[model samples]
Target: MGELKLMKGNEVIAEAAIRCGCDGYFGYPITPQSEIMEYLALREPWKETGMVFLQAESEVAAINMIYGGASCGKRVMTTSSSPGMSLMMEGLSYIAGAELPCVIVNIVRGGPGLGTIQPSQADYNQATKGGGHGDYQSIVLAPATVQEMYDFVELSFDLAFKYRIPAIILSDGVIGQMMEKVTLGEFKPRWTAEQIEQMSGSWATTGMKGRKMNVTTSLRLQSEDLEKHNNNLQAKYRTIEKEEVRFDEYMTDDAEYILVAYGSSARICHKTVELAREKGLKVGLLRPITVWPYPTKRLQELAQKAKGMMAVEMSAGQMFIDLKLAVNGKTPVEYYGRMGGMVPSPSEVLGALEKQLIGGANNE
Candidate 1:
């Protein structure tokens, strides 16, 4: 084993980015996510390893800075909260349209115009459906715990670079601030020069006089060409759905009732599973790591074995819709959550599960 340390998820993200040979970080300070920037400033990875950390004037500027760094074939990332993430949507669309490879972490707080400083999963629809104006998709990776924050970031970097697309670590405030024992493996970068070159060769702004400047843009003058570009992006997304769906199964091998959750809520659901187990309830957890790709297939498979699932979240069951779709009316799928930073406790979830398990309440 490398080492074990109790650290917050935000701190681990900064360290992990540096260890992954991140060349730059461009971000605007935001609530519940400021610690990541503060941690990077104190650690000063830039001083030791030439890594650049730039606190931009705003989130828009920050994401554009990410675009600039990525243009140079450098591994770059940014971190912010929900409000800040909203500000970056325009740039996010541009980055996606230009086919750039970069990582963005949104330590989400309550949403819809500065809602709260506490944790929230309200950004699920925005993240999965593309908050920007254009038809774009961000590879959204959700981490359920501080440990997964570290583990998933490494994977996020790989996916971002692999797909020549902007990838997001769609985490929340609780996971960012919570301290947990984390094990980091040997530092190994997911990208090689050849890999970077391949991505850049596809769309990056390398040079001009060489080959008509190789415009990095998402615009096409002809409708047919624009349609072609959109079609290509859609195909890439389909590829991700096939290869990038990730989730965790617990007590699910023989589960009669399944709990569908993601991010920190799913971590809470795990404890709920333990309590349900002692009470002789056949419960299990399906924790989706990629919120956008949404492990619908795996959950559908579980639906075949379980009576139903209760979608858990810090928001008002924002993910329940996906669960219902996966279940396809074959089983009951309900909702259990609190909005504006109110997280359900293990006892609260247990009570809800008990009500459903006994009463068969399908609250839609």
Candidate 2:
């Protein structure tokens, strides 16, 4: 173990970035996640690790800065809230089209417009289903605990580099502001120029140097070529779906009812499971760690065994659609949510579970 300390989720992100050898961070200050940039500035990783931490004028500029850094095979990232993330959607699309690897963290807040600063999981569709234009899917990770918030930052970078695509940490305000003990990882040195050439020279823009020039662009004026490129991207996504689906199942083997959730909502569902079990109900919690891959296979298998399922969220049930698709009518999947930054209490969630999943109320 490297070190043990209690840290908030946003601060852990900045610490993890430096320890993971991230090259740069470009982001604007946003509520519930401003600590990410503030901590970076306080730590001064630029002096210690040669990492560049720049506070951009806007989220739009921040994401584009990541695009530039990533194109050169540098490990770059940015952090934002719901509205700020909305501003970066165009840049996110360009990064996807160019197939550059980078990490983006969204500490989501209530949405639709400049909504409340409180936590919300309303950005599920925006993060997973191509928030920007064109056909693209970013690998999305949901971290429920402070420890996971630390772990996933490093994991996101690793996955991004491996796939040459963007990876998103789809966290919420509760997780961002919450504090817990975390076991920090060992420090890894940033990659050198030679290392970049050796590892990413094939596709990265590292100054031509005795080889044919490389162009990184999403633009394909030829229709046939564009189709081919799109097909290739789809193939990669399929492979990722097959290989990278991850979730956590608690007390599911003998579960009569299953609760499906992710991020902070999953934590609440865990308490609901324990409460239900205490009342002689065999309930399980299925928490999706990778929201994009969706863990549909595990859900399908569990659906066959459980009598009913409830999709709990802080939003108006955005992930409910995915749960229904995974169940595919084999079992009743009901939605229980509190929108506009309101989180359902454990008692409220248990009550909904009893009414919706146990009492056999009409699931609509």
Candidate 3:
């Protein structure tokens, strides 16, 4: 039987990593997110699963260690918040450049600088668009609850290993700190010795002999080869967009105004929906679960039926661009949000929606 309990989001992630058969975790402690490391350290996940947990010197070192582990085609992961995630961007760029498999969790905090320990969705651009200097993208998953915190981390690991690309979990303080019920799936062992031998035979860096020489570095000496690598990466991204888009739609069939948001902010939009209905307004919500894929198709489909969309967020308006791009100019995309650890209240979103229709200052 599966075990269900109220758990912290960070602890859920650490436990899920073990249950998912992740081979190793390398990360440094950062505020709000530090609990993730503490949980793993206390649990000693390695003892049960033959996993490895390394508390690296810094976020930079932690991600590089992830890089090293992933090169072996192993299931590896790491976690941090905004500022620390910024430190790992250099390594994130390298992981994407090399098309290696790894999972990263960013328990987002307000940012631009050290920001705050409180939750913020301001890293929308940093996680969606390549934050680091890169011509590559990571598959970004945004989880709004502790349940998704556990589940998305597992799925992100699977996607990372399956696609041989990086997977990122973008979450905020509301979800990270909120206690919620979650079911721990059955524990399973990682890749067997035979499986590892077969994988190592081809892609892994287990020493070059008895077959062809193996190379695991991201650098390309020849310009033509570099171009080929970049082109290949783009092709892979296109494939991912087609295959992995996910979102949730609420009461959108006969709606006149739509609310587009993701992560913890989407929950607040739920309340906004109810209030909008109390006022007899046709309001709905479109919450994107996968941030990188951006659910452009879903928003475009909603555009054909709805009048306009209010793009709500904890950031200024990052997801707004996505809503616009998704709708492809079919409707005006408006925005209302606050940053630096402030959770936009339900009333605030309702006010924005009301202002949009009455004041005519919004999507028109």
Candidate 4:
């Protein structure tokens, strides 16, 4: 075990990055997520762990800095809110195209041109469907609690390096601002240059060092070469889909109806599950931890037995599309959401489920 302490979600992200042996953090400050960089600035891990922390002038600069660091096989990361993320999209595409391994955290707020500083999950489509232009995908992890907010940073780094791709921690303002007790993981020493060379020797642009000069770029002027590169990328994505789908289920054994959700909304829906069960409503909850490599297989199986499913979100039904596809029309799917930075309570969610799924089905 390690140190146990109560900390805010953004603070733990900074501490967890340090403990996970991250080489550097390059990010700009944005509302609902500015605390992440603020915490790092206050902690000043440069003196403690030799970690590099830079407050970039803009989100664009931060993401490009990530590209440079990751090219050297360093564990680099960046965090931002919705507008800031919009600024980073092109850089994100470049990083993905170059196949660099780095972690990016998006503590999402209400969107569509600075909608609100409060929480919203509207970025669900943006994160899972590759906000950047191209056929690439990032491993998108949705953390529902403060503990998960800390734990997923390390997991995101692990998966990013393992697959040689960018990984994203897709969180919302609620989780980012919440505080909870977390058991800190044991500190890990930053990797030495020699260790980086040994681990990433295959393609990392460390140096010539008596070998062929390594080149890392996404440019393939030749159409044939670009197509071949895309094929390789697709193959990698398939492997990830096969191995990385992660989700959690509650009270699903004899569930007649199901609720699908992620991130902060999932937390509310958990209580909704308990409340429904109290009313003798056989309702279960499916929370997708990784929203990109979604739990489609499990949802498909559940669809065969479930009378209906309702997707609860903080957006105007973005993830609802994925849920409908996952069930493949085997069962009726409904959507309930609150937009413009509004968060629905557990009772409200249960009421939506009752009105949209249960009562509607009974009427039929």
lDDT of 1 by residue, 25-96 (tens): 989888898989999999998677778998899998998999888876778999998999888999888888
Worst 10 residues of 2 by lDDT: 355-364
Model 1 whole-model lDDT (C-alpha atoms)? 0.85
Best by TM-score: 2
What would you estimate as the lDDT of candidate 4? Answer: 0.93
lDDT for residue 303 in candidate 4, whole number 0-100 = 95
Over 253-298, each residue of candidate 2 has an lDDT whose tens digit, in order, gives 9998999999999999999999999999999999999999899999
> If both were scored by TM-score, which would come out higher, candidate 1 or candidate 3?
3
lDDT (C-alpha, whole model) for all candidates: 0.85, 0.94, 0.88, 0.93
In the range 1-364, model 4's lDDT, one tens digit per residue, is: 8888999998889999999999999999899998989998999999988999999999999999999999999999999999999999999899999999999999999978979999999998888888989988999999998889889999999999999999999998999999999889998999998999899977789998967888889999999999999999999999999999999998888999999999999999999999999999999999999999999999999999999998999999999999988899999999999998999999999998998888875332
Structure candidate 4, residue pairs in collision? none
Best by lDDT: 2
Q: Sorted by lDDT, highest first, which candidate order results?
A: 2, 4, 3, 1
RMSD of each: 2.0, 0.8, 1.4, 1.2
Error of 4 at 176 (Å): 0.4
Q: List candidate 2 stretches off by more than 4 Å.
A: none
